[model samples]
Target: MTSQIELKSGTAMAPADPVLRDFRNFLFLVWKHLNLPEPTDVQYDLAAYLQKGPKRSVIEAFRGVGKSWVTSAFVCWLLLNNPQLNIMVVSAAKDRADAFSTFTKRLIAEMPILEHLKPGKGQRDSNIAFDVGPAGASQSPSVKSVGITGQLTGSRADVIIADDVESLNNAMTSTMRDLLSERIKEFDAVLKPGGRVIYLGTPQTEMSIYNRLPERGYEIRIWPARIPADPDKYQGRLAPFVMRMIQDGKGPGTPVDPKRFHDLDLLEREASYGRSGFALQFMLDTSLSDQDRYPLKFRDLMVTSLDPRMAPVKLMWASDPDKRLDIPMVGLQGDAYHRPMWMAPEMAEYTGCVMAIDPSGRGKDETAYAIVKHLNGWLYVVASGGFKDGYGEATLKGLALLAKQHGANKIIVEANFGDGMFTQLLKPVVSRIHAVEIEEVKHNQQKERRICDTLEPVMNQHRLVFDQAVIEHDHKGTSEPIRQLMYQMSRITRDRGSLAKDDRLDVLAMAVGYWAESMARDTDKAHEEHLESLRDKAYEDFIELVHRNTNSGYEIDEPSWLN
Candidate 1:
C-alpha cells in the first residue's frame, strides 16, 4: 500500500496508509501527483489553517492564491481521515460549487491513495452529490454541491465548505448583502452538532460578509498578496503567521509568496484591476480610506447659497479649515463639504439652467430630479430630490414645479428606463406648468462608470458646486441616507450596483453632464481673464477722468509721469 514518489535526486517514500493524518502532507502529495511544483509557504499555511483552525472559520486569501485548490485537497484529506463525514460545498453559483466538488471527486478518483474512498456501486456518484465507499447510509450524500440560494434547507452536513460565496454579483448592494448574510445563517441550521464550516473567499466590498463573520464567532484569517504598508487597515485580521512576518521586518510591496506571484506579476495585475480593485481582490484591504476607490468627495464640492438665475462671475474653491462648511455630511471619513474661498462682488445672470430627471417605476427606486445652473465654467446644483410617486400626476407636477421654481429652461430625462415614455408623460404636465423643453437622453455605458466619468473630473476641478440649501434639503429629503444624493455621490465606486439607490446621483450626473463642454475652460485661465478685464476697466476709467478734467474736449495723450 506504500506509495513511492520518484524525485530527480532520489526516491521519496510517501505514507503507506491512505490517511496521511496531516493535511499539509496530503496537499503536497496532491500537488506532486498533479506534476505541480512543491507547495509554497502560503499554500502550506492555508493547509494548516484548514486542518487546525477553529471549527467555524474563514480563509480570506488573495485571489489566485490557490486557496480553493488547497481546500479541495483538504477535503480529500478530511474524507480519508473520516469517511462517514458528510460535507457540503456552497458558492455564489451552482456551477462554482459543482466545480469545487468535481475537483474533489476527481482527486479521490485519480489519486492512487484516495482510490479507496471512491463511490462504489449503487451509491450516488454525480458531481452535484456523491457518497464515499465507506460512508454509512444517510439522508444527505457524503459530498454535496449547492448554490447559496439553492435548496439548502433540509440538507444536513457534518462539514460545509463555502467557496467564493460572496461575489460582486451577489453582494453588490445592501439588500443583496443582507440576503447573503441571512442565507449563510442557514449553515447553522444545516450543520450538525460540533460540525465545522469553512469559508474561502476574497472580499468583494468593504461590507463583505467575510469581514463580519468574526462577530458571529467564526475566526477569520486573511493573507494579502503583498505585505501591507498600512497593516492597521486589516485591523489585526491578517493570519497570525503573516502578522509575525510583518513584525519581522517584512516590508510592504514584498510578495508574501514570490514563488507563485512575483512583484512584476502583481504589478501587472494591479494595473489591470486598477488600484482600488487590486486592493480588494489582491491586497485584501477593504478600508474605504482609499481615495481612488470612491472618486467623488464632498470636500471637492463648493457649498453655498446658489441663486437660481444669478451667480458670482468668479468663484474659487479651497479645502482649508476656514472654507469647510459645518453641514450634515454622510460621506466617507475626513470628507466634508467646503465653501468657495472667494466669490466676486458683482453677480451676473446664469448663462443657462438645466434639469435632469432619472425616472423610475414604482419600487424601491426613486424618480429623482436635479436642477443645475451654469455660469463662467462653473456648474451649480440649486435643487435636487426624488419622488416616490413614479410617473403619476403628483410626481410630474412636482418635477414641473421644481423646474419652474429653479428657473430651469431645459429638462433632460433619462431614456433608459421607460424608453422616452417618462419624458412623454412629463411633457404635457410641464407644458401646463413650466413650458420647459424636455429632452430624452440615453446612456450606453455602465451606470456606475458613466456617473463616475461624468462627475469625477468636474468635481475634481471644484467646478461642481452644491447649493447649501440643496445639501440641507437632501439630508432632510430621505429618511434613508443611501437614497440621498450626497450619500450616493460619495459612496459610489466604479463597480456596478455599488450603490443600492443611484437615482439621485444619476440625475445629478446627467445635469452636470449637460455642462460638460463648458467645463473644459481652465479655472486659472478664467481668473487671468478676469484680472485682465479689471485692468482694462481701470485704465478706461482713468482716461475718462483725465478727459473730464481737461479744458480741451479732445483725447489726452499719455503722460510720461503716468507711464
Candidate 2:
C-alpha cells in the first residue's frame, strides 16, 4: 500500500458509530486505545454531511488535502452503522482500486474499538480480509472490495465510490473514453433509485467523466481554490497547500527537464498531443474543432488493421517528372488511421482491385500517375513512382506488365501532349497487353483547379487515407501540394494569381473522378430493368418500319459517319 499520513491536530473528533452507546465505544478506541488525534476541518465537514440521508456526492479538490483519509473515515462510518449494506469501490486502474481497498482494511484493523469485530481474518494467507464473531455477526456490513473488470461485474452496491479516474500517465483515448462511458451506464442501470454515487478525483481533462456527468443532470458543486476573492488586497493565499503539493510533485525538475509533473502528481507535460491533458484536467475545456480535419491531428491521417492476421499492400499511381533523385520514388506502408495489415498475394482476392495510370511527356521534373483502390470503405494508396524518362512506348510497356501482374484492368493516359504521338506510342503496347484496357483522355483546363473541385467531397467524407511519410515527404514537414489545395479551397472564386502547382493533388483528383464515375455506373445499373422495357419498345418500332417497306424492298442506307 502507498504510504498515507494522518494529521494529528489534537482536537476531539466525532466517533465513527452514530448511536450513543456504539459511538462511546468507538471514541474510546480512537482516543484511549489507538491514541489517535482529532479530525481536520475537511474531515469534520464530510462526517457531518454523511450523517444525512444516503445521498452520494463527489469531492473535487487539489492534491495532498487528505482526501483519501477523509473518504476512508466516511466508508468506516457507513460499514459500522449498516453492516449488511454493500459498497462498490473503483479507481482509474485495477492497482489503484486494490490500494484503496487495502488501506481501508488497515484502518479497520488498527482501530482498537472495532478490533473485536475481527474485520481481517478470512484469508488463508495473512490479513487481506477480516471476519467477525463466528462468521455470522449480528452487526457487519459484509463489505467486499474488487476491481472494475469484466462488464460492470463489481458495480452493484448501495454505494459506489470512484477515486482519481484520469491519470496523465494513463491518459484517456477515444476507446478508453468509450469504456468509461459504458461503465457509467452500468452504474445507472444497477444503482438502486435514491442510492448514492460518490465521485472523488482531481480534474484532469475537460471532457472528463467528472465534468460530463453534470450535463446529464447530476447536481454539481464546485470547490475552487477560494470561495471569494478581492483583487485589490489579494495575495493569492487561497489553495496554498494544494499549490505547494503540486510543486512538490514536480520533484525538483526544471522546465527543460522532459519529465515534469503537473497538478494531482498525475498530469504530465503536453507536447505533440496538443493541449489535451491540460485542457481536460486543470483548465477544464472541451475541444471545439473537428478532430478529423484538425491541422495537427496526426491520427486523423492514420488507418489501422482490424484483424491481426490480414496484411494490406499499398498501391499508388501518380505522375512525377524528377524521378532522378535517389529516393524520389519511395512508397511507405504503415498505420495511418487503422492498424496496418500486410497484404500478401493470397489476400488480394479480398483486397485486390484495379489501378489507373496517367503518363507524362518530359518525365523531366518527374513522371506522374494516379492510383486508387478501396479497402474496408476507404480508398488507400497502392503504388506511385516518378522517373526522369517518363512513360512513352517502352516505359508504358513495363507499366502495363506490372499492372497486369497486380490484376489491374484499366490504364487511363492523358493525351494532351499530342494525341497523334500518344496513340502511335501506345498502339504497340496496347496490342501486346491483353489483360488491361488502355484509354486516352484529353484535358484543356488547369489541372489543379479541376482536381480540387472533384476531390472536395471525398476529403469531407474522409473517404481517402494517404501515407503520412509520403504526404510529409519533403524536408519542411509540409506537403506543398496539399497546402496549395487548401489555399485554393479558401477562395470561393478563382479570381487571382496563378495557383500553386499541385502534382500529388492532381493524382488524388483523378482517383476521386474515377470513384465518382464508378458510383454513377452503379446508379445506372440500378435502373437497368426500366431500360430493358424501353429496349423492347424500340425493337417493336423498328419491326413496324421494316414491314411498311416490305413490298418494295426499300433501299437501306448505313449511317453517314459509318459510311
Candidate 3:
C-alpha cells in the first residue's frame, strides 16, 4: 500500500503508509497478506507495546507464543517506514541469530507488499546481513545478525534487538550469568543515539539478567500463561509476573490465550514441569523455588505465647544459705522458652532434656544454642538463642545458666570448630556453677543434610513446637540469633548465595537430633534407669519410715541428707 495524499500547497507528498505506520495495522496487514491465522489478543498487544517504542524493554512471553513472529513483523514495519534505520538482531548463539534473520528475510521475500523492500540487486543478499534497497556508494547492510558472543563492536544500530539471550546452561551458574550480562552490555556501546534496546526472553532464574535489567532503566512487560486477579500486591516485585492484564476481559486464573491454551493442557504442563519448573516456564512464579529448596516451612512450626505463672515446673536460682545478705531467689522465666506441641495442650512429664551448641571463636560469628526436651516420642523446642562472646567465659557461663533454667541435664556442643575444646572449657565452669552436664558431639555429616534429615521428619509429623515470643521479637527476620535461626531454617537453600551461614540453624538441628536419636539410643537404658530410680526411692522412703518410727523420733530411718 503506497501512501500518497494531496498536500495543502497543491503538491502531492507521501504520508507514512497507513499499514507501516501503526504496528497493529502492520501486523494485521502482514498476517492477511501472508494468508495466516489471525493474531491472538496477546500477540497483537505485544506488537502494540513494541510499536509504542520504550527506550528499553523486556518482553517475557510464554514459550510457543507467536511473540518472535510478531517481533519479526515489527522489524519489517520499522524498516519499511524508516528505510535507513540500521538494526542488529542478537540471540544466544550464531545459529539462533541466523534463525531470526532467516524468518525475517523469508517474510519480506514472500510478501507481495514487501517485495520492493527486498535485498539489493547487486549487494549483500545473505540471511545474516541483508539490504532493504539497491546498494549505494555509501551503503552498509540495513539488517545485521550477530550472536551475543559474536562481533558487536565494529557495527552500530539504530535499534538493537536482543532475542532470547539467556540460555538455561548459561543461567545456571553465577559466572555464566555474569558473562552473559557483560556480553549484553555491548549493545549500549553499539547503539546509535536515542535508539531503543529491546530484550525478549523467558527468565531462567530468580537472578537472571531479565529480572535485573529493570534496575538499569529497562521497562519490562511480562505475559504469563495466566494473569493473577489482584495485581496491586505485585507493584514493585518482579517475579510471578502478576500484573493488571488488559487484553482479555477474562478475570484472573483464566488463560491469557484462551483460544490456543486449554485447561487440561495447562494443568498437564504444570504437573509435568513440577513446581519450580512450572513457575519458571508457565506461571512465571519464581517464589515457589525457595519453598521447593528450603525443607522447612513457616506453616510447619506451631506458634504460641507462654506465661511464667502457668509453668508446671520451675527452677529457681537462690543465694546460698551460707550467705548472710537477703538476696531473693529468681525463678525460671517461662516466657523465655518452653513451647509444648499444640497437640499436647498441657505440659507432660519430660524424661530427658539437652542443650545443643554450635560455638564460634569470634564475636562476629554467633555462638548459638537450643534447649530441647523429650517426652515419650514428642519433642519440645524449649528455648533457643545465641551468645556473642564466642567460646569465652560468658559463653560457658551462659550455657550453664540456660541448662539450669531449662532443667536440662545435658549440654551437647559441636566439637568440629574448637576440636572438642568447646565442652572441655565449659566442664569446670558448669561444675563450679551448677550440676549441669556438658557433652561434646563431633558432626560427621554436612550441616544442611544434618538439619534436613533430622528436622524434616519431626516437623512433618507436627511433633515440634516453637516459642511464639521469640518469633514475634524477630518478626522481620533481621537478627542472627535464634529468632533469625527460624528464618534461616525456613529459607535454607542448597544454593550457595541463598544462605552464607547456618550456625544457629545448626544448633537447633543438633538439639532436635539429640532428642530424636534419644528415642532410639536411650529407650531401653532410660526405662531401666527410671525403674532403678523408683527402686532406689523405695529404700529411702522417709514418710513411711517416719510413720513407723513416729513413736521413736530419734531412730527414724530417713536419709542423713534429708534429716
Candidate 4:
C-alpha cells in the first residue's frame, strides 16, 4: 500500500520546484521512490556535506555504508536540479567508475520527476559517459566516468568525484601509492575553477591520500560504522580517532543503521575478520588494522602479569640469564654467536645490566629508556618507560634515579640528534644524584631494521621477558607514551609506513645491542676469573702435598731444598 502522498504511476512528468530548491527533499524523494532504507544520521550528514559540493569533501565511511550509492544519487540529484552542470566520476578501476555513472544513468531514466533530465538518444548515452539534453552553454559532457589511473588528458568536469580511488590490490605498495597520488593531481588541471571535489573511500594505509586532503583546504568528513567513544575527544571525523574509539571501547555499541548492522551482526563480523580486519573494514581504523606487518606480536612476547614491584623475582630462569647474557646459545642463525635464551629460574645469577636512552627532549616526541639484565646466555628486561617532558632538571634527575634503582652498570645514549647533548646533559643530573657510567653510541643501521634484526632473533627463541607494566598497557592512541610504544612495537612496518616516530623501539634496541656487547665482555671476565681460581687452587694443593710429605718424615724434600 503506497502512501497517499506518493507519486502515482504514469503521472505526467513535472519538475518538483520545491525539491529542486532543497537537496534534502530531493534525497528524500530519491529514497522514497528507490525503496531504500531511511537515511541514518551519517547518511544525512553525507547529504549535507555533498550539498556544499564543488569544494572538497571526502566521505571516509565504512564498507557497505552506501557511500557509493549515496554519491551516485547525489550525482543524479545534481544533474536533475541543474541540467547545465557537468559532473565526472572516477574510481580505482574503470569498472568501479562505470558503476557510478551507470547508477546515475539509471536514476535519471527511472525517476519520473526528472523525466526532463533524461539523456537524449541521439545526443549522448552510454554507461561510461552521458550527456543530459545536449551541450549548449558548457560543451563538457554532463556526466563522464574514468579510472584514476586511466587516460583523461582531454576530459573536463565542473564537479569531479573520486570514489573508492584506492584498493588493497592496486595501492598496496609504495610504488603503486605514489603513482595513484601523482595521477590524482591531474584532477586539478581538469576541474573547472570553483568546482566541487568529492572523495569517497576507506583509507587502506596510515599514510592515506585522504589524510592529506585537509592540508590542501579540502574539508574531510569520516563517518565510521560506530560512534566514536570519547565523543568530545574524537569527533568521528578521522580514522585515527576511530582507532582510538575502538581501542578504548568507545564505539560499535550502536551502528549507523541498526537493521543492517545489529549487535550480533557486528560481533559476527568481528569474529570473522579478527581485530585487524574488522577495524579496517568496519571501524575505518587504518592505524589499528595492520598486525601482520610487524615482526612481533603480543602473544609471542613472554610476559608475567604479576607486577614486578610487588613480586620481585617471582619468575626466574636457570643460569640467571636475567643478569648475564653470555649463557651459550646452542642454535643461532648467521654468525652463530651464543645468544642466551632466558628461562624461569630453576637456578642462575645474572651478571650484567645496562640502560639505553633515546632523549627526544620534548616537542611532542617521547623521551624513552629501557633497562635490560643479562645472564650467561640469557637476557631479561628490567624496566621500560618514556616521558614527554623536555630535558629539564626534573626529567633528567628522575631518569638518573631510575637508572640507579635498576642497578644498571652502563647507560648507552643515542647520540644522533644533538651529538651527545642528551648524554652530556644527563651527566650533570647523574653527578648530583648518583654517578653512573654512561657511554654515547651512534647507530649506523636504521632504527626499524636494527630493531627487527636484533630483537627478532632474541624474541623468536623466546628469550626476552617483559614486565607487567609494559605488557598491560591499553595501547589506546590517546593514552600517550605507553600506548604509543605498544602501537609502534606491534604496528611498525618494514616500510616504516605506519608510525611517525619510534623512540621506545629505538631505546630498547640500543639496550639490546649494549647487552650483546656485554655478553662478550662478561664471558672474557668469567674466563679470567676461572683461570685465576684454578691457579690458586693448584698452588694450595701443592703446598698441602709438601706439608703432608714433610709431616710423613720423608727426606726427599731435603734434596730439593739443597739443590
lDDT of each: 0.86, 0.45, 0.68, 0.67
Q: Which of the numbered candidates is closest to the native, going by highest TM-score?
A: 1
Q: In model 1, how large is the Cα lDDT of residue 310? A: 83
Task: Compare the candidates by lDDT and give the number of the best one.
Answer: 1
lDDT of 3: 0.68
Give per-residue lDDT, candidate 3, residue 20. Answer: 50
Predicted candidate 4 versus true structure: per-residue lDDT over 94-156, tens digit per residue: 998998899888887887876667776576788888888634544567889998878765877
If scored against the real structure, what TM-score would every candidate get? Answer: 0.71, 0.39, 0.57, 0.54
Candidate 3: misplaced stretches above 4 Å? Answer: 1-19, 25-40, 52-59, 66-222, 225-280, 285-293, 307-352, 361-365, 374-378, 387-407, 425-435, 475-483, 493-498, 517-563
How many clashes (backbone atoms < 3 Å, residues ≥3 apart in a chain or on different chains) does model 2 have?
A: 50
RMSD score of candidate 1 (Å): 7.0
lDDT, candidate 1, equals 0.86
Task: Give me the runs in candidate 4 sitting further than 4 Å from their true place.
Answer: 1-8, 11-16, 134-139, 230-252, 290-563
Give lDDT tens digits, candidate 1, residues 1-563.
12433333223223344346667777877898898998899999998889899899999998898999999888888888888999999999999999999999998888877777889998999998999998888899999999999999888999999999988788767668878999999999999999999999988655678878988998878999999999877877788878888889999889999999999999999999998889888988876424666888888888998776788888888999988888899886567988899898867688899999999887647899988998879998888898898888899999998888888889999998867788889989999999978898989899999999999998888888888998998998778887898888877889877787788899999999999998888766765776677768878887887878685665666766446
Ten contiguous residues minimizing lDDT sum, candidate 1: 1-10
lDDT of 2 by residue, 1-563 (tens): 00222323333333342342233233223433335544434334444444442365556643444556566555665565555455566676767766776666665566643444344455221232234322344222344444444344533467777776555443343335546666666767646566787777765534356666765655433323222222111123223333344445533222211122333343333343355443333222233212222222222233332231232323222213221123222121111233233222322222324454455567443445545565434455444443346655557676666565545556666666555475567657756774556666676776645764666555544445554344333323334332332222322122122233344445556655766644333323323533455556766776676677765788554334323
Candidate with more favorable, higher TM-score: 2 or 4: 4
Q: For candidate 4, report its TM-score.
A: 0.54
Query: If the candidates were sorted by their lDDT against the true structure, best first, what order would they fall in?
Result: 1, 3, 4, 2
